[model samples]
Target: MLTTILNLLEVAAWSGIAALGFGILFNIPKSVIFTVFMLGFTAGLIKFSLMYFNVHIVLATFIAVFFVGIICMPVAHKIHHPPVVFCIPPTIPMIPGYFAYETVLSVMNFIFMEDDQAKRVELIDTIFTNGFTMIFILISIAAGISLPMLLLRKDSVKKIEE
Candidate 1:
């Protein structure tokens, strides 16, 4: 129990730092830095917690990004900046870097290896698996982030036009 809590905290802290760094890189307003950190922390916590309970990574990421999008809407309204500013930085931490890296590595290996049928088949399997997983995770993140904005567009547009 204690270990799980500590792990969650560690993930949260690191994710917050990553998000803050991206926010700085993006040149977001100084006042919004803390909010970005909190958003990142929340995203990490939600994603990690779901994964800890044995949820699939793709679904976990989608849920986490969706919640972040939902949460950022109100924060954006209060801060008077677009919700995307908050929504994007937090999601940087959730990107499946390992899967992407492995996909690329597998592809390179597949291309360079000699004509060993069994070895080639194995490499092809690895390439497809990792590549598909990475692609789905990215798709989910996009859907999760955009769904909230699309759903709330009417109200957001009305407010902006006023």
Candidate 2:
């Protein structure tokens, strides 16, 4: 129990830091950096918590990004910035970097390995698996961020214009 909590905290803390760094890199307003951190923390907590309980990574990422979008709407209005400013940074922390790296590594191995059919087959499987997982996770993140904005377009746009 304690270990799970600690793990979640660690993930959240690192996620927040990553988001804050991205926010800084993006040149977002100084006032919004803390909000970005909190959003990242919430996103990491939600995604990893779901994964810990056996949820698929793609679905977990979608749900987490969706919640971040919903939460960012009001904050965007208050800050007079688009919700995307808040949404993008938080979602950055959830990107499947490991899967992408593995995909590349597998491809390299496939290219270098001798004509051992068994190893070739395994490498092909690994490449497709990691590549597909990474692609789907990215798609889910895009959908998650876009869905809320599409659903709340009127309100979000109107509020920003006000």
Candidate 3:
């Protein structure tokens, strides 16, 4: 139990670091850095919490992204920055890099599956598994993040200096 709490904290911390790096790379303003970091941290916490409760990974990601989107509306309004600016950089940490890499690696292995039927089956199964997982995850992330903005009618906010 205690270990679970620690693990969540660790995920949040590492995710925040990744978010900050992405935000910096994307040229997110300095004032918005902390907000982006917290959003990313919150996303990690939400996903981990859902997974801890035995929710599916894709569902957890969808829920986290949707919640983050809902939260970002008020934040965008309050901070006077475009929701896209705030909403996107934070979600970068959640991209399933491992799955994407696995998808590609499995494809490569499948291509080289010379006469070994077991290896061919294994590689093909892996390719399909990782490929579909990546696709659905990306779809959920985009849809979840976009849902709130679709409902909101406000124009994009311009960056204001503090």
Candidate 4:
């Protein structure tokens, strides 16, 4: 659908900006900024598309990151930098900040609030749900993003000529 694609594009743009900030933090060189932006944009688009299709968020993240990793391989080969330089930057935007933040808030509330039996149980439930989801999603994204290195027949980085 045109509307879906347009929405995806908007998500990609915002995600690209986030990834660009991470790229700067990661010391990614200026020359590859576009590539890095595209990486995040594409990853976010893929993830969004899968989610739109009613895919599980964790599964969508894995698929998206795996796709990004595959795409990064050739780009890294062409640019002569390590694949991680390209791969990790894009995945930055995929980090589930909302879930992570909620997990933290849940823990803080559980710890700081005076113990009422009903409230304590409720807080624990929230913490477990958000915390586990946050941890697993992060792991899923990292694993998916890095799997290419393990699975690819070619080396991820070129050997420097001495």
Q: Go through the candidates in order and give the C-alpha RMSD of each one to the true structure.
A: 2.3, 2.0, 3.3, 3.1
**What local lDDT does model 4 show for residue 127?**
91
lDDT of 2 by residue, 54-144 (tens): 9999999999999997777677777777776767888998889999999999898888754789989999999999999999999999999
| TM-score head-to-head 1 vs 4, winner | 1
Candidate 2 overall lDDT versus native: 0.87
TM-score, each model?
0.91, 0.93, 0.90, 0.88
Residue-wise C-alpha lDDT for candidate 1, range 54-158, written one tens digit per residue: 999999999999999788767876777777677799999888899999998888888885478898899889989999999999999999988976886655622
lDDT of 1 at 145: 87
Question: Which model, 1 or 3, shows the larger lDDT?
Answer: 1
Output the lDDT of residue 130, model 4: 89
The regions of model 2 sitting more than 4 angstroms off are 153-156, 160-162
TM-score of 4: 0.88
Q: How accurate is candidate 3 locally (lDDT)?
A: 0.84
How high is the CA lDDT of each candidate model? 0.87, 0.87, 0.84, 0.84
Candidate 3 positional error at 51, Å: 1.4
Query: Scored by Cα lDDT, where does model 4 land?
Result: 0.84
Clash pairs detected, candidate 4: none
Query: In terms of TM-score, how similar is model 2 to the real structure?
Result: 0.93
TM-score of predicted model 1?
0.91
Best by TM-score: 2
lDDT of 3 at 127: 86
